[model samples]
Structure formats: structure tokens, C-alpha cells
Target: MVSKVKIKINDLYKIFGPKGESHVEKVKSGMGKPELLEKHSHVLGLQNINLDIIEGKIQVIMGLSGSGKSTLIRHINRLIEPTAGQIFIDDTDVLAMSDEELMNFRRFKASMVFQKFALLPHRTVLANTIYGLTMQGLEVKEAEERAAHWLKRVGLEGFEDRYPAQLSGGMQQRVGLARALATDADILLMDEAFSALDPLIRSDMQEILLELQEELHKTIVFITHDLDEALRIGDDIAILRDGRLVQQGSSQDIVLNPADDYVGDFIKDINRARVLTLGTLPLKKASTKGIALSNNTSLENAMKALVDAKKDSVIVVKGDKKLGSVSMHDIVHAATRSSETAGEAVTYR
Candidate 1:
């Protein structure tokens, strides 16, 4: 009963007009709802989006390009205004904030990391990390100490004197990560911060980010199109499609129980073995016995075990006692379910 909502995005919407300059006098005058207008003629850039990213949680906002993922992330920090809705960060109404309040919020409450690692190319790493503190008018010595601390935390300890152009993609992103962390903000809005790198570098960045999240526990609202990356970093995931929130839940739920055809199609080719758990697929309890497996193992993986064991089924165990089992038949049954088929997924704990 004590868990509180941290970041709440309530029924948000944003629209775009087909014409250049994107005029909407009716919306400005508060005479027309964006929904009705967009349905008939306007382009709905974002539609009735609702999300709650809890404090100290890593929530990934994932979708294909044009899925409104980026648009939704922008609303939290007022980088882009919503057409309608209320966004509250720590119960503070974001839209109602004055210029001073907004500035203070951005200065002390939220930090954003971009795909391009938006660093001042001319500035040294230490200088860039301290930029936000300088803007707040902190003493130069104090800011430098704080920046140095964060630089060390991000594994850029000796690179304080290096410029952005002197760093590699991963190294530059480390600087970006350092800058964001130096702000000591409670929330980090990352919009494809690692998407620009090669796969190897992206994996390294992901590990670095995971370590950072573990150390910082900042409520991160991340936007990404890569499914593996989403599964890697997200504690909860909200999927968007064509501006609407298609589904929101743990990554397990989305993979095992997709909300719609569109979502199913998206996950159709994913290696369910890597993404699912033994708890996701059910095993018929027999009249006699079963073999146990760690709750962490997936059915696709469990199937391999079943084959290797040459047994009728295998049990799911937490530590000692058996929780459940999966037979070869059960393995085939779960695996054979057409990724495109319309049916409810069976999950047993």
C-alpha cells in the first residue's frame, strides 16, 4: 500500500497538421479536441497515451520507427508540449509549472541523453560534465569535484582532459553518461542513446548503462526500437504503435502474451527461448513425479533439457522443491502455437 506513483502520463495527445507551419487555431483556442480533429483530418502524432514509470524502475518505451516512442519521452520533460493530458513527476503537475519551476525541474530533477551524445565538441570531458552545475552557478571548484566523481563512476577517470572528438563512440557516450549522471537528477530520459553505435559497442554501452542504473537507481524512461535492448534493460515496458499505447507490462508479458496481432507480428521471430521463462509455460501435474528447473529457465530452453534428460517432463524449482514440470508434448504444444495465432497464452507459476 505504500508504493507511490512516480511518473504518471495521463491520457496524453499530440497532433500534427499535414500543412507546413502546423497551424491549429482551434486547438490553441481550446475549441477542438485533438482526437476528433485528427481522426477526420489531422495527423495524430500521439494519441491518448497513458503510462506510469515507477520511481527507481527502468521502463522502456519500445516500438518501430514512427511509433510515437520519441514523442512520448519528450512530454515528460516538456521538451515537447502535449496536446492534452497531465504529466506528474513526483506528484508535481508538470504542465502547470512556471518558467522558473520548469527550469528548476530540468536543472535538478531530470536529465536527458540523446542518440547523438549531444556533447560540446569543443569542451573537455570534465568541462562538459560540469556544464549543468555551472549553469546553476555552483563554485567552479565544487563543480569540478562533482564532475570528476561522476567521470570516475562512468569509467572515464583519466579522460577528463580529452575532447569529444578525441573519444570513440563508446567513450563519447561514456562522457554523455557522465554528464547526465553528474546532474544528480532523479530521472533520466534516454532516447536511443546507444542506437547509433555498432552492435559490439552497443552491447558494451548497455552493460555500462545497466551498471549505472544499478548504482544510481534513477527512474529511467528509455526509448528504443531494438527488442533485445528493451528486454536487456527494461523492468517494465510500454509498447507504442501509431501513437497509441498498445500494451504495457513486464517484458515477459509482452513476449508471452502479446495484446494484438500487430504486437504478435512484432515478436513472431524473436527467440522465445531467450525471452521467456519456465513460469510462462504450463506442465500438467502427473499422478506420480517431476524434475525441477530454476524458475529463471525458459520453456524453449527447458525443452532442450527435456530432450537431453530423455524423460517425460522436467520440474521447475526455485531452490529445492519442485514447482512444475514440462513434458515433451508440453514443449511442442507451447512452441507450436503459431506466433500469428489468436489465443490466450497459458502461464503457470
Candidate 2:
């Protein structure tokens, strides 16, 4: 079944300077970012970006510094107005919202989690979590009940009374997450939300997010510069460079079929075994009596299963229906192939 598109961005353009609108024509007329800056003294932040964000799926926007990744995310909530573009959330025009409508949208329809753990230093954890609910004029008892539930959900049940400075960085970020989740918004805007944590903590946070997503299925827009994180969490990824989109696709698609040399370099050193899945491998009609594996199983896990079971091939199935059989040779070849040669000989469905 095809998922519904929750957010649609069309012809998005952002330019920075006093006369940003004036330079939009030049940018649309084929002026590059460097030339625009050097000649017009205006910075081009984004150029003609078009994307569809699926409902209840995580869409990650990633790139190096100055790639306009953060800028693009902010546009979803209209924190930064575009030079020219249209943003549709559930087919409703976001760019056309009045100030009051936008304020209500931010308060009820979506919530943001920042990288810096933007908690109130003066308020207790419970108070901070209930901040948004209170802003919406919810009753004190109801707000507290909602905040307490989300705090416990994020593993901060016992830390409700502690101030932001009293907790470690990871704990503080958890508070920020709980606060965002407490609002019960349909859309979650995470702007490099876990980029500030240590490696292990970041992994833990990712797991937490995935677990919650399995239950809540909120429409998530996650921003990051780390390719590993993007592949691990994003249902779809959009890569940007110099204020323009480089590529956009699933993790397997990008890993196996990079759009260009720029995207290829980003994924060249990545471990293909972890990113590619059995469902992406070519399906064969030949049947096998080996062990059965789910179609979504990773190549890394499939290899381990094969070695443990002492089998040369395994049957890939979706539920009880068998899709095809994949041999050990095919798995190894797919995982070990160089990224530059990817999607050349192998055809992934």
C-alpha cells in the first residue's frame, strides 16, 4: 500500500540579504551559489527544492555545514520565510497561514526538538515538559498528567523535579524530547536532535526513537550531518549540497545507486552489509530448503544466519509467502562490492 504524503514542498527557494526576493530571478536563471554571493553579495540558502514527506515516516535531511539542511527544516514551520515557494501540510497551504493560524499550528500540529536541549533552566523537568500544554491553556491537572506520562516514556520518570543543569547532557536532551512528545503533535521536527550526544548515548537515543515510532508513527523530519545516523533512522533521506538537492531516496537506494559522484563519495566507505537488505536483492525462482529469513533482514544478519546454519542459501519470505532464494555467494558479492561499482551489475528491486 502506498503511504500518504503529509508534507509537500514545491519550488522552494531561500536567499539571504536585504534584497533576497530580487535575486530569486537570478538564482532561477542559472546563477550558482558562489557566483550569486561573489557578484550579487547575497547568499543563496536553497534553490528550487521539491520533496514529498510521507505520513508517519521519518524523513532525514543531511549534508555538510552550509548545505542548507537546517534552513530547509526551518521552512517546514516557517521559522524562516522563503524567497518563493509553497509548503503544504496535508494539502493545506503553510506559507499562506495567518500569524494566528501559524502560531496555533506550531503549538498543536507540530513540535520541535532542538540540538542544544532547550529546556528552562529555572523550571523543573516536569514544569518544562508541561510548558507547551500550559501555553495551550490546558488544565493544570491534565497538563501535569500528560507531562508525567511522556517524561516516563522517555526514561525520565524519576527525574521530574531535577533542573536542567542538574542532569547530564543526555538526560537533558531526554527532557527536551519528552517535552516535545508531551505536546502530542502529529508532526515532530527534530533539528539535529541527537547530534550533541556522545556516540553511545546517540545510539541509545536512536533506539528509543525507533521504538517510539513503532508505536506512535508520528511524521518525523530529522536533520543531521552524519550519514550513519541518517541511514540508521531515516525512512527516506534527502542529500543537499551548496543549497541544492543532490539526491533523495531510501537508504538502500542511495547506498546501492548513488545519484552522482558527490553522493557516491558520501556512501563509498559505508558498510554495505548493514545498509542493504534481502528485499532489495534480486529475486530468483529457484527454491531452496535452507533456513528462512525475513525479506527485511539485513545482509549482515543474513550472512551470520547462513554461517550459523551452515547453509549456502536461504529462502527469503514476506510473512509465509516466499519471495525468492538468495545464495551465500550473492550476499557476499553484494556486500563486498565497491560503492563506485554499485548498481552497475546488481539490479535491486
| Residue 148 lDDT (model 2) | 97
Residue-level lDDT of model 2, residues 190-289, one tens digit each, is 9999999999999999999999999999999999989999999999999998889989999998998899877887787788999999989987775867
Model 1 CA deviation exceeding 4 Å by range:
17-42, 286-291, 300-312, 318-321, 332-338, 341-349
TM-score of candidate 1 to 2 decimals? 0.85
Q: Which stretches of candidate 2 lie over 4 Å from their true place?
A: 283-289, 341-349
Candidate 1 residue-wise lDDT, 63-120, digit = tens: 8887888888989999988777789998899999999999999999999989899999
Every candidate's lDDT: 0.82, 0.92
Q: Let me know the TM-score candidate 2 reaches against the reference structure.
A: 0.94
lDDT of 2: 0.92
RMSD to truth, every model: 5.5, 3.9
Lowest summed lDDT across 10 adjacent residues in model 1 is found at 20-29
